[model samples]
Target: MAGVQDQLEIKFRLTDGSDIGPKSFPTAASVATLKETVLAQWPKEKENGPRTVKDVKLISAGRILENSRTIGECRSPLCDVPGGVTTMHVVVQPPSTEKDKKAAHLPKQNKCVCVIL
Candidate 1:
């Protein structure tokens, strides 16, 4: 049987400098699952919260956590102290609109387009 040492304590650090938890989770839990938990536990008072799981991004040790990766796999020695709680930054980015998408695909021009008469 897995003991307490097998579990990890994690807290999500919001952009507003608030935290969601120091909740204990099994190492087997997936990052996607954690995102779902974040969505569920998100503060009702906070504005511009994530509307979907895809909108949530978890960053640890300066790297974004992949949904397919398990919590155990995502553990960073730099952030995950043996008995201390690990704090991961949560970034909520809304899905890009068509306008934003179009702009992203637009080619960058090196020369100035302005012509003086």
Candidate 2:
């Protein structure tokens, strides 16, 4: 077991305008586990939003964190993050609704078309 110093206090900034934690998690914890914690604590709402891990992206220091990496592997040792409290940004990518899908496939008008007299 690691000592208290090894534990990292992390806060999440969710896309739904929700902020979760300043919670302590072992630095050894995998990014996948971190995502799970965020998803669990994510606010439940009627509005459509990211419903699975695949729909969400967690970014730290301008880099999207990979699920396979451990906090310690990304932080200490590798030294990506500093000691003490840290905040990460979460992006929710909800699957597009059918209406949006239809619009995307529609042909876009060319803005620079020349009129033939």
Stretches of candidate 2 off by over 4 Å are 76-83, 96-117
lDDT of 2: 0.78
In model 1, the runs with Cα more than 4 Å from the true position are 112-117
For all predictions, the C-alpha RMSD in Å is 2.9, 3.9
Query: What's model 1's lDDT at 60?
Result: 92
**Which candidate leads in TM-score?**
1
What TM-score does structure 1 among the candidates reach?
0.86
Error of 1 at 55 (Å): 0.5
- Per-residue lDDT of model 1, residues 18-98, tens digit only: 999989989999999999999999999999999999999999999999999999998887767887899989999988999
- Which ten-residue region of model 1 has the weakest summed lDDT? 1-10
What TM-score number comes out for model 2?
A: 0.69
